[model samples]
Target: MIKIAIADDNSFLIKTAQEKLSFFDLAVKLIAVDGKDLIDKLEINHNIDLILMDIEMPEMNGIEATNFIKNKYPHIKILMLTVFDNDENIFNAIKAGADGYLLKEINPKDLHQGILETLNGGAAMHPSIAFKTLKLLRNPQDFENRECQEEIKLSTREIEVLEQLSKGLNYNTIADNLILSPSTVRKHIENIYAKLQVHNKLEAVQKAKSNNLI
Candidate 1:
């Protein structure tokens, strides 16, 4: 039997997915409340073949969880089963290594077909999402910029600090230029690094410049 795990924050949605899959000859191995809950349960029982992941969840989001699961359990297939079909969500889910993307409103027969297609090394994407994916592939730079804008949102102070840092200014010099304390400058730098997902000053400046953040 094809063992499956469903991860959705809403209990009603989880039940709905369960009912949809009930028509198939698959087994519902577990139903998790959210991304973090799914990871925890998988630690104990990860014998499932696939996971129906929701995008927005408490503790950890689906994209983050999918990245982690793909890294740790590369054998398991992840199908993003979410209501959100936005460009950012779709691009991020694909980048996180989801095997398929299906809308929550999909009928049982199509849902079952999607699951099987995903297991058989074929992507099961909604037609609209498939069109977006093709556009993304055609113009990756545009999608990359869009994805960067969505993920990295910096405050004005953070931008100012990054600008100073880009000019080879130390924390104290940045504080002097911005008329803020050295500690405050340091805090702003920390926030910038976190938002930009960078380690040091050089990487932060490079990322900020590439994304047009500063």
Candidate 2:
């Protein structure tokens, strides 16, 4: 049986992946919740044949894991199984040395076939993903616009928090002004940072301003 590794933050998704591979001659040898976890596990047991990697997670993401694994364990195959089918994610995963790109919605048979094809050195991809890849290649200019054109959804409260953040207001002051507790304000800011995909106050504010979210 081929040894398989699954890297995803959600336990449900991990279990689903295992169920999909249940009937095949593949064994789920290891499971990791994030990219850092996957790397640490691989350090102990590098015998995994293929890894089903998810793109978004808490500590580290699949693209980063794929890059690191490709550098350290060139023989191991990585198939990105994610829900994100955006142009940026697709190209980034490809550049990170992912052997295949399949959405999480794939059925059992297709997922198995994708895995087998990837193990055989084939670049398996979802049909929609393949079409998008061709379109990206044909119109390279679309890559930049596709990312920016997508609307960044934020709650009304999140936007208010962002606006307060942009004014250089401290968490306490913002909370007082908005009639919220300090810890609630802090949580709102955390959500804002996550939604904007920014780390610091400056970055979050700047991204919100750039995207016109604030």
Candidate 3:
């Protein structure tokens, strides 16, 4: 049986995840309330193969926790199951070493499949996020690539906005930093999103990173 651990702040979510996981008949070895508890469990049980982690919590967030896990137990696969779609969070999670990224709204069957696939040396992402990943890849203009006469035109201000966004800044923060009204910032972001054909920040940043735009 594949040994798996779950870390989430919500007791209901923990129980729900445990129930969903039980259908697969894999060993549900541990459940942690926060990042610290998760790490503590990892200390005692080194055989866990996969972890379903939540991004937000009291003691420590999932990003920091994932980083610690990857440093100490590089072999353990982690699948992020959180509500946060912030580009910075997603990129940081990827950098810190998450095998897959899934949302909390995922169906139990898919969640089980994601776990099995991760354990079997494959990566998985939510379908919504996956779509964004594709759009980001096709944007040659975003990254520095020559030999293209036809390119999506982006104003300097728009580029500036996208660059900050690619760095993981939220709309409000980006607006404040740029000294623009929140509405103006939102408009610029909307234009960028439309030009890039991406739905969310994570997708936009992923595309930018792959192109070395940020």
Give the better candidate number (1 or 2) by TM-score: 1
Question: Tens digit of lDDT per residue, candidate 3, span 115-157?
Answer: 9889889888998766654554465344234221125566789
Q: Per-residue lDDT tens digits of candidate 1, residues 86-175?
A: 888988899999999999999999999999999999999999999999998789899878777778888888888899999998888888
lDDT of 2 by residue, 1-214 (tens): 8999999999999999999999899999999999999999999999989999999988899998999999999999999999999888888898899999999999999999999999999999999999988888787766765565365678898888888988999999999999999999999888877777789999987877776677
Q: List the residue pairs that clash in candidate 2.
A: none
TM-score of model 1 (CA atoms): 0.72
Off by over 4 Å in 3: 134-214
State TM-scores per candidate. Answer: 0.72, 0.68, 0.63
Per-model C-alpha lDDT, please? 0.92, 0.91, 0.82
Residue 191 in model 3: lDDT: 83
Report the lDDT of model 3 for residue 159.
75
Candidate order by decreasing lDDT: 1, 2, 3
Better of 2 and 3 by lDDT: 2
